[model samples]
Target: MSPTRSHDGLDIGVSFEFFPPKTEKMEETLWASIKRLAPLSPRFVSVTYGAGGSTRERTHNTVARMLRETPLKPAAHLTCVDASREEVDDVISDYWMIGVRHIVALRGDPANGVGQRYQPHPEGYASTPELIEGIRKIGDFEVSVSAYPEKHPESPDVVADIELLKRKVDAGATRAITQFFFDNDVFERYVERVRKAGIDIPIVPGLVPVVNFSQTAQFARRAGASVPAWIVKRFEGLEDDVETRKLVAAAVAAEQAFDLVDRGFRDFHFYTMNRADLVFAICHLLGLRAKPEEVAKATAAA
Candidate 1:
């Protein structure tokens, strides 16, 4: 049997990723997405920080609100980019004070943009490994780091990518979340390589429901993830058909999640892009259910 096949009765746990909104409209959309997905009993939810700490205040405030208002455990993304060690440390301390125990540590991209030279701040943590170490020193955070299934664009090869992950694990990353990929084989092969390296961290596959194929295509190019030619063909000429596109998006994502679950991956991290209906439908198809507490709350609200 393929390793991907589901084993005995293990419950699948899901988590979601949302970016901090920059406008009131976006804020409304973000909260709508959160509330829509909240009833599914995700293991946690995360708010992403922008490149070079651009969303620092918003990220902190959003995460703080989640702690105060929601049952979801909020993981805040922290990066060592364009900031001093002291500045980064202050941010970490702020998160800790707000009762956050999880962080996604990253060596952020250049503020100028991708393909530009990356220069670490002389006083800040350099790479993700260094960031992980710094986080561990400050608090017992359940630190998760990024993994590139197709290998980081800056990496010379897959071997180098695996080695980098090992270094982060050694430095105290509790888990690894991969960049989104359409091909499950990429994830499967990456996991195989990760296990062979003797690093036993849970590598959760990140799922992006392709609501807008063109936007996702552009993003995949920027992030160095490949969008298979066949996938484009699947959504070909549907640009003007928003409803049909959404239906297709849900079906594709649902199939991918079901296949992963069958393969024994019980954890998934969805990149929601602040859209709720599609991701919510996909999670429902994955057998996720609201706990009684959440259902009661939803019922009361209704």
Candidate 2:
């Protein structure tokens, strides 16, 4: 992908992903980060469901709170792992009743954990496409499904991955958020392939600001994302330097976002890891700012 110098006065769309907090202190931190990023007016924010639907209640509570207390649209993540159809349908109904119109449907990892073979419950929706269809039947939800630019770990090839995405789109998924990747060319090529396969939904690239390089690298390996050699070199010798690591993280993320923008991508999804500092810095670099007027209006409404 050749980068273009078209950085002057561009408006872009962004969405954020957050995981439900597991404790009171983490809850406080999550809320603080949400309040900070809320002012920038993301297109939508999503809260993740834990593996095997373990954090179902926590995820629901977080989404409900966002709906009630903030002026932001929240997308609840629903997974088809160890859940019966009726149970998952009930969750979908509950979200609909609470005014949630968007859902991120996923085929969650095996209940045993990552790297384990995923076995769908006997009475559950077997895949993400089935989950999307179930949500549509429950209500008119704007569903989003997962995409893997480098191909899902379990997928045999890119063709199989795109076929799955096509099924989800046909089942009513309107958007696909990809797994985070370090290489822009890989994403660009994936986008082209998705389009050529007749899947027209938005394939938003997911960006992760490396809060902890080692941890992020581990996650990348598990999720089938490649960690470019250059990224490893960038974080080299900063093992104990917290402040400088953060600075490098912000710079690297900013460069990636800007390069994607130059390639004509106007929408992005950020995996925030429940923190806002690095994401906020990258958003600023992408020309997104918190409009004071909008903030004041939201505050007054609250």
Q: Best TM-score goes to which candidate? A: 2
Q: Give the alpha carbon lDDT tens digit for every residue of 1-302 in model 2.
A: 01112246666888999999999999988987887788778899999996545499999999998988888899999999888999999999999999999999999999888899999999999999889989988898999999999999999999999999999999999999999999999999999999999999999999999989999999999999999999999999999999999999999999999899889998889999999999989988887878776577456544
RMSDs, each prediction?
A: 3.6, 3.6
TM-score, one value per model: 0.94, 0.95
Off by over 4 Å in 2: 1-7, 51-54, 297-302
Which digits, one per residue and each the tens of the lDDT, describe model 1 over residues 144-163?
Answer: 99999999989999999999
User: Judged by lDDT against the true structure, how good is candidate 1?
Assistant: 0.87
Superposed by TM-score, candidate 2 places the C-alpha of residue 18 at a distance from the truth, in angstroms, of 0.5
Q: Candidate 2's C-alpha lDDT?
A: 0.90
Residue pairs with backbone overlap in model 1: 4-262, 4-263, 5-262, 5-263, 6-262
